[model samples]
Every structure is written in C-alpha cells, then in structure tokens.
Target: MKSPKQQSGDAAERRAETLLTGRGLTTVDRNYRCKGGEIDLIMRDGDSLVFVEVRLRRHKDFGGSLSSIDQRKQRRLIIAAQHYLQRQRWQGPCRFDVVGFDGSHEANWIKDAFSA
Candidate 1:
C-alpha cells in the first residue's frame, strides 16, 4: 500500500500530465526514478523533450510549492535527466518545467524553469 504522501504525489503528477496534455504536450514517461531523484513527468512538446516537476501545496503559508525546488533539488533533477538521456540515447532538445499546484485545483506551468 502506498503512503498518503505517495498517493498525493501520484495524484499531483497525474494532474500535471493532464494539464500539460491540455497545453499540447504528450507524455512519454512518468515517475522516472534514479539514484539522484525522480522526475514526476517526462513529456514531449512537439519535438522537444520536457522534464516536469510537479509541486503541490495545500496552502501557501510557507512560501509557494514551486519555491521549494531549491538549487540542490534542481541539481538532483538535472542529474536524473542526464542519466535518462544517456540511457535512452536521446539527442533531442530538452527543457525543464515546473507545475505548481496551489490548493485551488489549478496548476501554474512554468516552462523552461531551468537549464542544464
């Protein structure tokens, strides 16, 4: 059985996928885990690969959820992304995206949130 946090994270990733699809992005892989970290969603926007990080916060009392992805988190995601590309032999353009879900059932998608 998954813990509550795990379930919530899954739900959030699903929501992010739906949101991205609505915006013309197609999902390729999801919940990609590695030694460095996990990428919530890996999608394709046209010919470009997109690595999405889904952030959900019940409230904004302690900064926004997207703000929680600090430098260390970014580095971990980068490492995981590089590992994924190397394993898949992917040589296409890629970008990082952040989908921040505020409690009100809306997620703000930040494209090109970071670069390698």
Candidate 2:
C-alpha cells in the first residue's frame, strides 16, 4: 500500500498533468527515474521538450510550494533531464518548468523556470 504522503504526491502530480494537458502540452512521460534522480513529468510543447517538476505544500508556514525547489533539487532535475535527453537522442530545444500547488489555491505554472 502506498503511504498517505506518497498518495498525496501522486494526486498532486496528476493534477499538474491535467492542467498541463489542458494548456496544450502533451505528456511524454511521468515519474521518470534515473540512477540518481527523477523527473515528475516530461512533456512536449510544440517542438520543444519540457521537463517539469511538481511540488505541493499543504501548509504555507515555511515557504510556498515553488520555493521548495531549492538549488540542490534544481541540480538533480537538471542532471536527470540531461540523462533523459541523451537517452532519447533529443537534440532539439528543451526547457525546464515548474508546477506548484500552494495550499488550496490554483496551480502555478512557470515556464522556463531554469536551464540545464
């Protein structure tokens, strides 16, 4: 059985996926993992490949959901994205995006959140 936290995270990722798809992005992959890192979602926006990170924070005590993606996390995402690109032989344009849910509010989608 999945833990409550894992279930909640899954729900968050699903919500993010739905929102992205509604906005015209097609899902390429989800929860893609490599040796040292994982990507929450891989999507295609027009001719560009998009790597997405989904974050959910029920409480806003310390920081917002988007703020949780710190430097270390960014590094991991970048490394994982690089691995994915090499494996898929993707030489086209790619970008990083972030989908964050803070509390019970609407989703926040930030395009080109960072670079690889």
Candidate 3:
C-alpha cells in the first residue's frame, strides 16, 4: 500500500521518463539507492551517461520544482552518482540533469545542472 504522496511521486517520475525518452535518452535504471543517497533515473544521452533528479511541485511559489534542489541535495546526488559509476565498469563522461514538473504544465529538463 503506497501513500498518496508516494503514488504521486511515482507518477511524476513516470511522466519525466516519458518526456526524456521522447528526447531520445535511453533509461538504464530507476530509483537507484545505496547508503550514500538515491538517484531517480539513470539514462544515456548519446555516448554520455546521465543522472537525473525529478522534482514535482504543486505551485509556483518559492521557485517551484527547479529551486527545490538545493546544495545539500546536489551533494547527495553527486556522491550517489560516483558510487554508481564505480560499481559499473563505465569510465566515460557523465553529467547531472534535473527534471522539474509544475502541476499545471509539462515537465522541463535541465541538462548538466550540476557537476562533481
């Protein structure tokens, strides 16, 4: 049994996935988590590996979903990404992306949103 909020989050992630796929990115993993942190989606863009964070906000106040990803969260995401790459044999270039969704509009993708 999932709570309404969790269900909503799942739906939002699904929507983000669809939008990314439409842009030609291939999904490699979902909800990848470890002791360090969690990554919402792991995708591939051309030859680069991408780590994405999906945010959903009900209103435009306080910067909406885009602004919700503050410094601390970015740190966690970076650490998680490093762990993921270490586990895999991949030594190629990678970047962090953000997908913001405001309830009234379509999802927005912010590529290379941050770095290590």
Candidate 4:
C-alpha cells in the first residue's frame, strides 16, 4: 500500500494536472526523470513546452511549497529539461512552471516560474 505521504503527493500532482488541462493545456508527460533531476509534469502550452514542479506542503512549519524550490533544484530541473529536449530534438520554446499546494483543493500555478 502507498504511504499517506506518497498518496498525498500523487493526489496533489493529479490536482495540478487537472487544473492545467482544464485551462487548455495538453499533457505531454508526467514524472519525467533523468539522472540529473525530475520534472513532475510536462505539458504543451500553446507553442511552448512547460516543465512543471508540483510542490505540496500540508504544513507551514517550514514555510510554503513555493519556497522549497531553491537554486540546486532549479539546476537539476534545467539539466533534466535539457536532456529531454535534446533527446526529442525539440528546438521551439520552453519554460519552467510551478504548481504549489497548501493542503487545498486548488493549486497555485506560476508560469515561467524560473529560468535555466
């Protein structure tokens, strides 16, 4: 059986995916991973590729989910993204996005949340 924490994270990722697809984005991939890092979700937003990080924080003791993504994490995401793009031979446009959860039904989406 999945642990409560794992289940919560899965549910949160699903919520983020639903919110995005409802807004006209098409899901390209989920849980894209490389040796460098992991991308929670990857979606097509118009002509661009959006690499997403889904962060769910049920408590506030360590601050919010948004603040959890620091420089090191950003670099890993970037490296994974680069690997994905290269393997797919994609040369259009790409951006980083963040889906933050605070024990809520709705997630907060930040488009172009970070740069590589």
| Alpha-carbon runs more than 4 Å astray in model 4 | none
- The alpha-carbon root-mean-square deviation between model 1 and the true structure, to one decimal in Å, is 0.9
How does each model score on TM-score? Answer: 0.95, 0.97, 0.97, 0.94
lDDT per residue as tens, model 1, 1-116? 99998898789888889889998999999989999988989999999999999998888878888898899999999999999999999998999999998787688889999898
Model 3 misplacement above 4 A:
none
Error of 4 at 73 (Å): 0.9
C-alpha local distance difference test of each model: 0.92, 0.94, 0.94, 0.92
Q: Write the per-residue lDDT of candidate 4 for residues 52-82, one digit (tens) a residue.
A: 9999998655878888999999999999999
Candidate 2 yields a Cα-based lDDT of 0.94
Q: What is every candidate's alpha-carbon RMSD to the true fold?
A: 0.9, 0.7, 0.8, 1.1
Candidate 4 RMSD computed on C-alpha atoms after optimal superposition onto the true structure:
1.1
Candidate 1 deviant stretches above 4 angstroms: none
Model 3 residue 25 CA deviation (Å) reads 0.5
Clashes of each: 0, 0, 0, 0
lDDT comparison, 2 vs 4, better candidate: 2
Expressed as tens digits, the lDDT of each residue in 1-116 for candidate 2 is: 99998998999999999999999999999999998699999999999999999999998768889989999999999899989998999989999999999888999999999886
